[model samples]
Target: MSKRALISVSDKTGIVEFAGELVKLGWEIISTGGTKATLDTAEIPNVSVDDVTGFPEMMDGRVKTLHPLVHGALLGRRDLATHMEAMREHDIQPIDLVIVNLYPFKETLLAGGSYEEMIEKIDIGGPSMLRSAAKNHAFVTVLTDPTDYAQVLSELTENGETLFETRQQLAAKVFRLTASYDALIADYLGKEIHVTDPERTTLTYDVNQRLRYGENEHQAAVFYQTALPTSYSIAQSKQLNGKALSFNNIRDADAAIKIARDFTDAPTVVALKHMNPCGIGTAETIEQAWDYAFEADPVSIFGGIIVLNREVDAATAEKMHKIFLEIIIAPSYSDEALEILTMKKKNLRLLQLDFSQAEVSKKEMEYTGVLGGLLVQNQDVIVETPAEWTVATKTQPTATQFEALKFAWKAVKFVKSNGILVSNEHQTLGVGPGQTNRVGSVKLALEAAFDKPSALTENAVLASDAFFPFADNIDEIAKSGVKAIVQPGGSVRDQEVIDACDKYGIAMVFTGVRHFRH
Candidate 1:
């Protein structure tokens, strides 16, 4: 009997050439619909599914290649006499190779296809054939990815058949592909029905990059990204220069981008280290923003990730080049800026991201994985204005103090829990995050802010991620000469905290919304 190969594909990349190569090797080709027409146009000898199954393709090509003759050929055990006898009785010719790829459901969903169009794009017969062939890998070869075509053909040409190990690998790939395909369809349909928390949930990601190691050198890690990447995401960023991003670099870059996204109204700069915002600044120009952010924490900014809302200019790049930064992310870079940044710092990763669709990007869900399960939540993208806050102190904040409080509130949201930030109108003076106690964070922030005297520090305002449980936090804030304070104001001792601010002549605002990053 002549060796037979089945081929059907939605992505027709290199399919004709692959089929042609198989034909040159004396293998009979079986195909369906467009694949069959494509083979015929290429003068490649092929048999259609209609001829083999004795059933006409129907249901708008949804019912093709699903009959027993096709599946039995793929699933029958060639080594078993019983299976062989049954195949002979049914006039079933065993299929030696199965090549298939599912319909473009993911592509359609990402393209914003209609509900009916998405439903139509889901493949039924294709996955069935793939699973059948994959199950009998002991006697059948399966190929779902086109990249495997060349290797399978080379093996067949040299050895007259694929190695058992090769067949097993291909079989595994088929199951993985089919599983991902099904998960994508299920996720899309689940959202259509407004099912936020289904009893069973499936998630999928494609490997974006394989890192040399994880946070530590001994651990291994890989970066996986969603099928539909968001515009403001670091995974979707285009690397223009420098070495491949490490696991830590990616994490810090993600934090930096999120913080920068919170301040889109002005030219903003965020300096992040170890997934914590060390300094953030918003100003009229990218250059000024860089200067303020750099001045905020010159020491911690070393080896940190820098994210900018506006394009990087030559002046900003020159100032940034003075530090031993790990990464720099920005919307774009002037030609001169790129040249300056990439000139000597070959290991510094430079990522260019588009923030035009940033508001849309905020709609994506955030995920956190634990040992045995995962946690899902909406991203913390809410922005509250100072006008919405209530004056919690007898002394209301001045316009400059209100603006400074607003900036501090925005910056503090990105900090770790027990967070405290001190800033003027345009730049952060100090940030104390992840402290064990609220007062500890307040002390750390105050100490840093008063470490040096500057005009900005004289009119500094403070913001907290959550309410201060005790008045000691207010006492600590008083030592820093911070003129205004902003906090969630939900603590039971809220009155005591307010009285302390009044005693110190500090203006305080209650936002009524907590922003605990942890």
Candidate 2:
């Protein structure tokens, strides 16, 4: 018996050669409008659906393949007496192979299309034929993705027939293709037309890759997305170097971007360890930012990821080569900087992300795993500049101290909750973070300010991302000889905290905002 195959697609990749090979193997080629035209252009003899159905193609080529002759060939069972009898009465023969891809529904949405554009792109006869072919997978073979074409062709050439397993896999892909197509259409209609369709937002996506593991070795990890977009999703990146990304690497990189993105000034640097900013500072030059950040905590930033908001220069590159860091996420890197960095740390992950173009589109409510389920809450602990802040303190900070306070406030927001940071002139002296008590956090911040008056006066400016609910914390910080103070003053004892600052002659300014990250 001779084989029969049908080819119809909006994407005509590899279809002509595929049909030619099948025709050479004594298989009849059946196709639709543009598909048939393509086969004709290739000088491959083909039968159009109109010729098979004994009817003219009508309604702008939409009614060509919806006739009973086409579907009966796909749906009729080969074994049953009643099915065989009905097929003979209708002059129908079983279709052995089905090659089809739907209209450009997904592509239309991605191309900034409107409702009418999507509605027009939805394939009616294509889905009808696909479902007809996929449901009879035991008898009919279905092909949707062009990537599967070469595999199917190779299998047929090697064995002279496609395996049942191959047909099953293609059928599954057909369902997935149709399902994803509808999800895009529904999602678009819901957004633009406000179509209160309850079925719209339920999204389904394909897995792109699986990481080495999740947060722990015991857990499993898989990454997924609706589509591969250039600046968005991990799958879109070209992994130029480094080992596979762990869960912690992605999390810390995300934190690094959040802090580094906002600083468009001369040079801003942030060193992140375990999803918190271990050190951060801004300066008139990139080298200065690197110097200040390195001097902040040369110990804690040993294996942390560093993010620089400005292009790295040779001076900064020379400084970075001495440290053992995981990754350096920056906007760009000079040739001299690259040469220096690559020589020292060849395996280091160097990523040049578009800081100005990327941001979290929506505030994803954070989900932390618990015993039974998970804890969920909004993550908006980002701190802003002092110019937009309301100063509730009696004594205001000096102009120079105000800049240091804003820099500290921005960095501390990325730190763990109950965190504190102390800095002066764009360099952190000591940072106390993740401590339980407020006073403990204060001590952790000012613990390294020095015993000598010269060192204390030169590099001691205390900053709290929040307010001091009591004056005792102020007295202890004064003992560290913090020459200035900056906080979001909202406590009932704000006056007492102010009094302590006056007694020590410490300049204090409140931004009237608190940033607590947990």
Best by TM-score: 1
Q: Could you give candidate 1's per-residue lDDT for residues 1-518 as a string of tens digits?
A: 88999998877899999999988899999999889888899999999989999999998998988898999999999999999999999999999998888899888888899999998999999999999999999999999888898899889999999999999999888887888898898988888889988888778888999999999999999999987667778889999998999998888898888888778899999999998888888889999999889889989999999999998999999999887999999889999999999988899899999989778888888898899999999988776766779999999999989888888998999889889999999999888999998888888888888885677697799999999899988887787678799999998999999999999999999999999888
lDDT of each: 0.90, 0.76
Q: Compute the lDDT of residue 507 as modeled in candidate 1.
A: 93
lDDT of 1: 0.90
Estimate TM-scores for all models.
Answer: 0.97, 0.81
Pairs that collide in candidate 1 are none
- Report RMSD for candidate 1: 1.4
Cα shift from native, residue 44, model 1 (Å) = 1.7
- Winning model by lDDT: 1
